[model samples]
Target: MSTDVVQIETRESRLEHLPISFFASVMGLSGLALAWQKGVHVLYIASEWVSLVIAAAAALVFLTLLGLYGAKVALHPSHVVGEYRHPVKLHFFPAVSISLLLLSILALNMWPAMAMPLFAVGASLHLVLMLLVLNSWFNHDHFQTVHLNPAWFIPAVGNVLVPLSGLALGYVELSWFFFAIGIMFWIVLFTIIINRVLFHNPLPERLAPTLFILIAPPAVGFLSYVRLAGNVDAAAHILYYFALFMTLFLITQVPRLMRAAFFLSWWAYSFPLAAVTIASLTMYEKISGTAFFVISAVLLGIVTTVVTALVVRTLVAIGRGRSACPNRPARDPGRLETQ
Candidate 1:
């Protein structure tokens, strides 16, 4: 073949070994599903169909990426190990586990037969992954305040995500176990992250969107707590208010976020926004008001727009040979610089 064809073939090979960060798309899509499902109840609209479509898309993306990542593990095991060992990339591993949990939640109402087993698998995997990630945090020696960011919340926050579906699946005891783990470490990590931000250099611009992740634990925790506790008690109120406060605080930072250069990390913003949207809808259910409905509707719109934009950008980047792969040099001349 000619040089052009050879290079195109080579690029395709590398793209197949995409970074673990790609799973953020799954998280975003799952969030969309949850947001819309909640919107359906509050708005009295046919939004559940939208949620189902997004959920199906998320599952397809999850399976496709899983297959690709599996291939990479089989062919380039060292690369996978290297990612797990890297401090920044390691935090994203929970994206996979969390995505599975979110998918299980979607399935819970839509596909009950599959939901129970999916929740079991998702919950089991999340717990095991949380332990492994925490162990890595303790063992890894590259300790510095600058290394802390909201991405660190994933593993710990993911534990709380389990009961969003697990409770419906009759895994009440197991859900509580994971929720306790998630909330406890969420507190520990929340303090550490706050200290790191206040004392150290700011996180790099590429990770700016990850700051949104700080909103997710409390938001998701509120939803999970309500599910497990079966009421909107004082504790649930505290979680809800904190999440609302964080959501407002983060909203003020959107200008800064917009100014930052885009990267795959921008996908970090999608799921958290969706989490808060769900939380808002949950609150709407508890306290009926036009204001609550308005808040939920607006947040849902913002999340849907963001995820859709990111998906389009990713497809464009892929077509242009600009989707950066961790394991190989980007082939297109302007690829690395743009995103």
Candidate 2:
């Protein structure tokens, strides 16, 4: 190819790859961490501090990579996926990944000193992204049976909640402002989605179930905040658990949307990972007995194993254009990097 043609091709390729590359990388980090966290339980039974340390170290590295990517995205907005078009949603992976890395570092260093800021960053950015999503949908036509791209929402919410989970550790500050903003976001997002289903444009059967899938992560975040903030009152617990269960019920339909197992979206397929995480919370709250934590932990382990393997496989397949029932072939990998 001529050099000019090659340059044009490269630029086009960069635009195409921007969206999925960030998502795949972010999901890869979450999947691997869940796997390691679950695996460590077995090894730690033997008091394997060394193994635990190594596992934690690996997690730190993963978080660092995720954070670096986020920083790159923030510095070079052109690299933001789908930035060329509406600029509706500012993908939260970059911001959330940085928050996760910082939180992890604070935890490892025993730095109560740094925990509050990390926590605030996580909590605030999460609210910001949620608001953006809400505002976008509120103004746009979200119905019309639009073909949902699982890649977009999956990593978006997952990455945000990963750090938001730190709120559970009790090392962070709570702002009523943040929570209020979050509620507004929730209001807008749900309104638009409901409007689509009920009034405006109805999603087709094929695309309909994906709506349920999109609800998973944010639902998880709601549950995670309640769980992590620790000390839920009777009313609070009841509300949170009710929402949690409903979310899980929604997640059950994901496989149906994907149809053939071979045709599952990298995003839709990974819903199980988020589902597993949600399941853990459910078990944590539902069973109040001594065996409660253990049983839930086991479920989390199984879910983690299955989800992580699936994510890794998808990454490989997408990287090589070998996905079993590929919907969209991913762009060239090199175009993911921005100068």
| Top candidate, metric lDDT | 1
Name the best candidate (by TM-score): 1
Q: Which lDDT tens digits does candidate 2 get at residues 1-339?
A: 899999776545533343423343334344334434433453243333433453354446446545554554665566554442232223334335333433453343344565556555655565555556556645755423333233235334434344343544543434334444444445455555565556645554323434544444444445445554455545445544554565566557656654522322333333334444544445455545655466456645554555556556545654654322112333432111211
In model 2, the Cα lDDT at residue 294 comes to 65
For the record, the alpha-carbon RMSD of candidate 1 to the native fold, in angstroms, is 2.4
Model 2: lDDT of residue 235? 42
lDDT of each: 0.82, 0.44
Candidate 1 weakest ten by summed lDDT = 330-339
Candidate 2: regions farther than 4 A off: 1-16, 24-28, 31-84, 87-175, 198-229, 251-255, 258-265, 268-287, 290-298, 321-339
Candidate 1 backbone collisions, by pair: none
Per-candidate clashes, comma-separated = 0, 3
Deviation of model 2 at 61, angstroms = 8.2
Question: TM-scores of the models, in the given order?
Answer: 0.93, 0.58
